[model samples]
Target chain A: MISFYPGPSQVYEKVPKWVKVAFDEGILGINHRSGRFEKMLAQVYQLLQEKLGVPADYTISFVSSATECWEIIAQSFVQESSFHLYNGAFGEKWCRTTKPLVAETAGYKFDFQEGLDLDQVIIPEDVEVICLTHNETSNGTQIRPSLVTALRENYPDTLIAVDATSSMAGVALNFDQADLWFASVQKCFGLPAGMGILICSPAAAARAEELQRRDHYNSWLKLRDNAIKLQTHLTPNVLDIYLLQQSMLERKPIDKVEEKVFTRYQQWSEFIPQLSGVDWLVKQEALRSRTVLALEGDPATLSALHQKAEVAGFTLGKGYGSWKKSTLRIANFPAMKRDAIDGLQTALLT
Target chain B: MISFYPGPSQVYEKVPKWVKVAFDEGILGINHRSGRFEKMLAQVYQLLQEKLGVPADYTISFVSSATECWEIIAQSFVQESSFHLYNGAFGEKWCRTTKPLVAETAGYKFDFQEGLDLDQVIIPEDVEVICLTHNETSNGTQIRPSLVTALRENYPDTLIAVDATSSMAGVALNFDQADLWFASVQKCFGLPAGMGILICSPAAAARAEELQRRDHYNSWLKLRDNAIKLQTHLTPNVLDIYLLQQSMLERKPIDKVEEKVFTRYQQWSEFIPQLSGVDWLVKQEALRSRTVLALEGDPATLSALHQKAEVAGFTLGKGYGSWKKSTLRIANFPAMKRDAIDGLQTALLT
Candidate 1:
């Protein structure tokens, strides 16, 4: 099948080969404490940094999924309050998960059609953490790094956490500006789901160490302690980590990979005007995600198109939650082949 | 190297081939919303129930890891009070993680060398949940089913939850007697880490549904609601699920698998007595685990043996936490070969 589903997108053709070797070599069975497993995980983290331009002092810990990252952040930090900015489903979901953290969390919600209005977002003086999504996969919106840099400059005491689950590999992230960044292996990484990579700055680590309640399995402090040994706090998705390592090895340097992905996204954006009965859902070009392209169409027509595409051996991602019928998301991750894109176009025309 | 690390035990010889086939067939990217993925997941659940003897009314959901299951259970069924029975590192860790349920959590510590004393255990009238580990991988002690059954009969109103992370497939479990049973794929299933299987009874389901503060992702109600459609409430470890499904297909009937594992354990039990300076850590044969066999020895001597075994191409599991230096854990799961066991014996003799 020509898979175009967002998040669990198509992986590199070589990934399966490496996974087979990983199992054959008994890498799957190696104890997480063994030198071999530790080396592998260290290499994975190294490659992740190389591919994403993460700072040298930053540490990456593998957890279950991006949703778990939200829990870990809430459980480890934000003892008092957090400022959550929500523009789409994932951000809203992140805010909902933080209900257990404090009596009341301050949140700013924006319409799907509107970009995050930084001026309208009120961060309380005592809010120690600011949570937002770098890319809103559900609505194909992107939050600019400049806004985050501004947030850090204005609210120097507040820690910035970004969920870049769908945009990390597709766009260039200014990791140095964000205290913490997390993403699932699916989405822009173009791999199957299961693992989440959490990139933590030294500041976040210090904050985690100070929090006495950070004792959960996926808690930042626990993960940070284990990560020092290049091991997860629990048995991680070993095979998935191996596949992600392979993908990172095959990925061009960050700038090149980002340029390639952004170029394809530009092609898709330009093509939207040529297509009849479909319009770009994200209003501002700067606010649109390079990896997930959201399109506005009639509910019945979109459903009909989805059925037709599947029958023609192409699979398209469904509009999520509130956008369930009115919008459709197309993934433009690097792993998607030109032929698959052609197939999608052909199916659409028919 | 010869690998014998417990609970991330060896994979079956056919796993690589099956994983390759799964990837080649595009099963890894199968639309989770489609009937194909649902059918595959349903088949997996059906096979798991048939092989493990889970009741027909029970429901199963795939999670990222068994550790994730702890969060799900604690966040879902645990409201008023939970009594945790701890005998090993994992059990203690679980209690620590669930400490936030403090308004409702009571921890009962036990000697790691002895089996649970049901009569001495105090279950407060307000304690609505009782959590225990079926097999303490850290110490190679197994909780007897008969003892658990008695506890259930006495506290009929309390929810009985078991973490069978290291024991499920290696031993026979009476699933009908437990409110919830969960295990990771890395253990007796002989697959890579990442996915956990959770089986829950209707009683547990009702309690979760009644939780007023149920958050979406970790909420058991959402998981069960999604499981009816053979889908995960959040993105799952798709490739690991495929790998686990393959492992389950290759698993022998539970009775037969248990017999083989038990026989191996008996051999180890008989053989360990012959070795100088080595003794069974659990003391009582009835309390010993069939899969993870913990051997007591001098701290220096055990450390030397670990180094020697690694040089001889065998990787042994270290007794977890406090027992790390004084004990050696031998895994006797189905994936281990007779040659590997014989090699371990030879190494010990040398």
Candidate 2:
């Protein structure tokens, strides 16, 4: 069945071939300290930078998942307090998770249907980091790049960290807008749900270095040091890294993927509003996400639609958190072709 | 090539078949919160308990790697000070890593050639946890179960945490001797790396609950709570977990595997002493490890021997850390057949 369950939704067509190659070449069992692994990691980093528009100065750390990144960011950079911009479930969860670790976590909650108002955001004097979720996968609302640019302009001293979990590769992100950007590979890289990629700008690295709290294994400094040597602080999932490398090899250019994705989202966003029995979660066009299309409907009708989609060989994403029964979250990740989205739309109408 | 690189050496023979099954079932893209995933995780946990003798009261948390366990232990259990029993590189590294996180970390280093002297070991009044490595993979020496039993008897109030990274499934560990036990899947479970299993006994759970420092996503308490529902705190490497579960299915029981490993190690320990060039690192037979055979010799000769073995379609583990040139580490994990070890012996003699 066709799957569109947001992150970990679908894998690239090349994964099977790469898995075979990894098995044949004994990639899984190779020593992490060996020259082979070092070379593999170096190439993987290079591919990531090239394909994702990561800055040449930015360092990438391969971690377990996006949630781990939240802890790393909190421990390494947020020495005192972090100001979070929250609108949806994911944003709220991030703030709640970071509150206990940091000295203080303050958030300005926006309506789920509305975008962040930069004028209303307050950064206390002791705030060390400004946290924002670029794409809230839970409600299909996304933060515009202008908001990040505004925050960077206003809070030049504080580090800006962006959770780009659901939109990093599916769309073009202004890398310079935030000091740290992170995404899990399952969303747009079309890999499985085991690895996370964290991009740290020089500014973010400086903030971590200034704090020098290298208490955890995946501390930003330790991760950066290991990345410099083309390795991780611990034995990572070498097979997943290999799989990601394969997915990035000779694929459609990131820009092309983004264009296709946005075009499909644009069409669907217009068409979905005209459809009966469902309504878009985010009211504002600019606040809508290009990666995940969250549609709110009657709980019974939504459940029936999900079941009917499955019967038609398509699987739609169930709503997350509190909206589990009333909303349908459809992933428009790079791996989802235009025809597939069209099929989902037809299935929904039927 | 026949791999013998200690951990992440050779996976179980049926890994590819199981991976194919996962792919066929679309396991990679399935939601972690789905009923299907819950069933898979429950079965995996059951297989681990049956195969490794994990206590019925103990809970398991699937994490990224063994190193993550160190951070979890330090944060969740070690409120102030921890006494580490250090011997080789790994043990020392654990102590060093934990030093930065806990309020105070102290260690007594033993010579690589010797095991821990329980009678001489000191415990300070404020020491909350005692850390031990079950198998020092670097030097091919293992801590006998008697030591853990003695420690448990003497320090009933102190938490005992075991880093069973290299010898968990290859040996029959007394799970009751330690409050927490963790192992990486690549070693004896015969799966690729990237996933770690953390087994927390009732006492360990009590410590975590008493402290209630569930800030981080992978905090011990958070992990335990999630484990109750057969889930991890974060999106784990689904493919690796599936591979591990497959490896556990219909495999040799832990006792049978342990007997085979010990018998093989006994034969090798006897045969290697008669070899012309190489000598065993751990002098005492009782202290020698059953999983990894660390053989020391002239650097040039060892390198040449490793090359010869590779040419003969067998790959041997190069010396690790400081003994990079003078040691040949051979993995005798469950995946390695008796004939393969015999073949390695013949090649080394040649």
Candidate 3:
């Protein structure tokens, strides 16, 4: 089936070929601490930095998943507390998950469709880090790079950590806008769900070192010590790293992929209004995500639509959290082919 | 090259074929929380239970690595502190890693040439957990099942956690002896390095509930909550889970595999002693690991042997920690082919 599910949405056509290459080259059995592994890791890191346009000073860590980054930030980046600005469920979950780990966490919510109002939101002086979701996968709302860059200007001292799970590879994000950024490879990388890419500016590293919370295995400072040496704190998912290297080697640069993503997004934006059933969940066009679109309908209607899509060989993402039955999400990732997109649209019409 | 490095060791021959099946089935693109994924996970969990002979009340959690399980146990299992019994680097590393996270910790190290003396070991009353390594990969030592079962009888109130990374699938472990047991898939399961299996008993679950330490993403309580629903707390390494499922399906039962492992261990024991140069690192045969063999040699001799093995198309594991230059390790895992084992012996003879 052609999957339209957001995150783990679609496999890149070249990935199967690459996996075979991995097998033929016997890359799966090498020791993680060997010189060979170090070289492989270095190449993958450099490729990501070049293709994703990350600054030279920003270093990256290979983690288990994007969710683990929340733990790392809460454990090591915060001295007292964190302030969370959220518009939807995924963003809210990150804040709630950090509360018990850190001394305190305060969250301020905004309307998902209305977008963020940084002008009115107040940050607690004790807050050491500000957490925000760059793309809210659960609600199909996005805070653009430009907006976060502006937020950086407003809060010059507070470290900004962005969850870019659904948007990283499909969008061209300015690395200077945030101190720490993370995403799972299952989404835009179009590989599988096992590894995460954590890119951090030197400021974030310095803050982690300052807090000195190296108690946990996932402490950001501990992670950095090994990462700077081109190694991981623990035995990593070597296959995924190998796959990521091959993926990045073949992927068009971020800007080109972002252009295609926006064009595809525009097609969906114009066509969804003409469809017989379902309406956009995010009313403000500016707030809607470039990588994911959530469509709202009654439960019965959405269920029927799901059935039709399944019968026609396309699997749509069921809604998450509170939107479980009322909405369906579509991924507009970089590796999603034009044919699959058009075919999904054709099936929707039927 | 046939890898004899203890882990991320030789992969199963069938894994590449199974990966092809995964690609054709489009398993990589399926959403992790979907019904299809849940069923897949349930089947994998059941296969492991049946094949590994884990107790009925013991539940399994799929994590990123065995190292991550150290954090989970420290975070949720111990009420005050843990007492560690170690003979080598891997176990000592675990203890040192936990010191910062735990309130207090004490370690008793035994001679690697000898075995653990349970009679001489004394654990404080406040030590709520007793940590041990089932197979110490670093120095090729082991703590057998009967010993741990006896340890359980001595401290019935305390939790026993075992790191069985290199031996879990190759040996028939008595799950009743420990409250928690963990292993990485790249070793005995013969899969790529990306996932870990954590099996926890009902008592461990109850203790986690009593502690109520749901502070982080990798918390045992949080992981169990989702695990009971046949879901992972985060987007997991889906590909590895798929591979594990296939690996378990084709695997012999734990008892049968254990028999093979012991026979292979015997073969190596016979062959290594007849070789020209190296000597056994552990003089006591009873303390030696069934899945890994360590040989003692001078630094220059070991380095030359490594080069010789490379030229002969075999890879020997370099020693770790204190034994870095003076020793080498050989894996006697289940997936290693007999021909490769014999071939390595021939190369050594030359």
> Quick one: best lDDT, which candidate?
3
**Which consecutive 10 residues in model 1 chain A have the weakest lDDT in total?**
A212-221
**Candidate models: Cα lDDT each:** 0.82, 0.84, 0.88
What's the lDDT for residue B289 in model 3? Answer: 90
Deviation from truth (RMSD, Å), model 1: 2.5
- List, for all models, the DockQ compared with the true complex: 0.58, 0.69, 0.79
Candidate 3: C-alpha lDDT: 0.88
Clashing pairs in 1: A7-A187
- Candidates, ranked, lDDT: 3, 2, 1
Q: What is the TM-score of candidate 2?
A: 0.96
Against the true structure, whose DockQ is highest?
3
The TM-scores of all predictions, comma-separated, are 0.93, 0.96, 0.98
Task: Name the lDDT value of residue A337 in candidate 2.
Answer: 61
Candidate 2 lDDT, B288-331, residue by residue in tens: 88898899999887888888788776788888789877788988
Off by over 4 Å in 2: A270-275, A337-343, B337-343
If both were scored by lDDT, which would come out higher, candidate 1 or candidate 2? 2
Reference contact recovery of candidate 1: 0.59
Fraction of true A-B contacts recovered by candidate 2 = 0.66
TM-score value, chain A, candidate 3: 0.98
Taking all chains together, the TM-score of candidate 3 against the true structure is 0.98
